[model samples]
Target: MATSVNRSCLTYLLHLAQDNLDFRLPEIKALLALRGKSFHPSGDFQEKTPFWCLDGLAEEDVRGVMARSVCAKSAFELWGHGQTHSELRTSLLNYPSENMSPFMHKDSTYRINVYTFNKTLEFPDRIKRIDAMDYLPFEGTVSLKSPQHIFCLLEDYGTDPNDIPEHPNYIYFGRWIADGQRELIRSHSVKNRHFIGNTSMDAGLSFIMANHAKVNENDLVFDPFVGTGSLLVACSHFRAYVCGTDIDYNTIHGRGRSSRKNQKWRGPDENIRANLRQYGTEEMYIDVMISDASKPVWREAPLFDAIITDPPYGIRESTRRTGSHKDVTKHADGIYLESHVPVSQAYHLSDIFTDLLNFSAHHLVVGGRLVYWLPVYRPEYSEETVPLHPCLRILSNCEQTLSSHTSRRLITMEKIRKPEELDGLAQFADGRFSPYQGHNAFREKYFSGLNKRCIKEDNKAVVNGQ
Candidate 1:
């Protein structure tokens, strides 16, 4: 049996994970946007808070959001909420009889659970809290082992550990709906993955990036700086056709030293395609190639539905691209050998982003997304440092702190217009479209900080020994 669904207006509660606080809002909004809807909060909501009460959503809409959200832990149909226990009782009393009657039938089986945030309670204390909810006319028989209906009494004790409140700051009672796909983190852990590399992305963040890109079935996703195809693995899980290009021939061919401990060399079939096969998404594997990002090989047409990549940060991998100032030795008729290995030159951080934005502007379908990481020297970073293009609009930028002084931001941009003939050349001529000067010096700043840390550690060790 189902109650009348007011599709346009209903309140739902989302219990989000505490970590990745910066990514929660964008993830939810992106998911909602996929459904042709927008996020509408009912109360004074804080983005960092664990609980968010959203209006303008039905149970199905909440379930849909949870289906793709890694930041959300669970969601529920909000029956009632209040600032205090007495207020909660009054709120519960005001809930419509018809709305509360469905799950409280005399013949139904039900259970009530007590959950507290930022505080722990004894078993008896938890029992007492559940007993206090007896004021609700739950005519159903209690079932501890297996319940037909599960209701939760959630209490918020505030986020501070030092100043614990004796009473909850807020309370919510709701019917448990669905849980997010957070298990994907543990299941797709890089430590247990079949093929990985020195800078293989963590599985959780890869899924986050995929979600931010709004990748869906049959979508063609490309990673320009694919190292061991971590982003491709994440996209393939969503049933997207995945392909990539990397400057490192060894990475493209999977014919080099192993990244795993105790392994001398990479084994046969140890490649990106094999990774998809291991996860049973081999059919989604498009071909990967050895190519420089600076000199793209794709035709001048909108091809990729989404471009998701993590360009080298010069920490774990050397950032180099093919070509040198020295003239190439020419054979008869100015011919170069097919097997010739061109000398690689330092690919500046600024040029990498400029070329990427230009390539995405030309290759991405309108409304398609481009998601990539931008390494930052924390002190010098600002909104201006992010690369820009006239045809692409920046959607969201979330930072993941790596150290005290270094962080990498996940920048998501959506292509809004087709590239004009001048679009490619405009980025070079226009100073506004160019990357901020600070970004150009990231490589130098990164090493300076690293060297300082090493020196500080050495000094600390010497003093401790003395």
Candidate 2:
């Protein structure tokens, strides 16, 4: 009981990668939620910083989060921290001797690493920092190559590159636990992907999306607008059974023009399943079919464990669906020729989200998440613009900036209840609930900024005569 109490009170330090500043917290929180844990900061917390001190987690809980987190670089069992070396010494001396004795035994071999955020230290300086820790009782032999235990001395120089501090703003020392899955980003990069499209999701962002959805082993995942199946690839990597639908026949069959440079056409072997196979997750691939998002073909039941997708923003890929402005005439027998082709019409961004939310409400299991991107004209964006449904609740809204005037928000929502008869008509009854209809003009606003920039460049060129 005493050992368990000591373990429960232990604080853990997380060294998060500085990139994707907006996504690190949500990703970590979702991963912790998967382990049935809550995020409890030990002190004043700064979300943008590289170091985070957490409480209310066991060593196994930290390892479980590290196993799937891409935002975090490494986790440690915090021993002592302070703003100055003298204070750190006092803190370390005040720490329980029993908690520090196991790893510092004479028979053990260990190594210490010096990590400085937003700064670099010379070899002599790093060695001096290690020497400064001689005040602690460490009887273990130092092993530089391989060791049974690893510890780190982390210093924060602040986030600003313009201002470099002579002394660190904060300092922390801890025993290393485990490293996060950052290597997955490099290994699964779209640049090296077998099959890709014009708008394939980035490898890091793809994994972040999967983490945000809390995808787990054997979970059934679906993507409504699965272009070349980048999101599917991420989900399958997490051991989920993945499938998707797209309206483009060529893309669905991988017979279209190649997305690779200098390659005019895609090879027969290049397809969504082949991409999964390339990563040795072909068993997770269920199927990919040519279908429209506006007209889902799934049965009326909560089937999917999670829905993750990146819908077309009418920029790189035109938002379209199977439909026509003109009326179609049916034969007396109500049949059409097998060779007849259906026409497609513009799928406005507003209606696209409406259909997506409604579909998720009907198809996603209770507590299942729906993660997707929503393009925004930054100047006119507001919380009210986000689409809402009676059965679904919004969880997170993170932004990825594209240009000065344009950006995309990664919106995560969960199904809290089944849809009722009035749920489908709730948006119509309330104007605020349907403000996304104004987003139909997103494409126009997106291009208007570019046109203005071009005109300005032209005026400057005319003023400064060649």
lDDT of 2: 0.93
Q: List all candidate RMSDs to the true structure.
A: 2.0, 1.4
Q: After superposing candidate 1 on the true structure, give the runs of residues whose Cα lies further than 4 Å from its correct spot.
A: 1-8, 331-338, 425-430, 461-465
The top-ranked prediction according to lDDT is 2
TM-score of every model versus the real structure: 0.95, 0.97
TM-score of 2: 0.97
Which tens-of-lDDT digit does each residue in 169-269 have in candidate 1?
A: 99999988899999989988999888889999999999999989989889999999898988998899989999999989888889899999999999998
| Tens-digit lDDT string for candidate 2 (1-466) | 6766797779999999989888888899999999999999999999989999999999999999999999999999999999988878888899988888889999999999999998999999999999999988889899999999999999999999999899999999999999999999999999999999999999999999999999999999999999999999999999999999999888999997998999999998999999999999999999999899999698999999999999999998999998887997876798878666678999999889999999999999999999999999999999999988888899899999988998999999999999999886786897766646768888999899989988999999999993
Candidate 2's displacement at residue 364, Å, is 0.4
List where candidate 2 sits over 4 angstroms from the true fold: 330-339, 461-466
Go through the candidates in order and give the clash count of each. 0, 0
- The alpha-carbon deviation from the true structure for residue 144 of candidate 2, after best TM-score superposition, in angstroms, is 0.6
Q: Name the TM-score of candidate 1.
A: 0.95
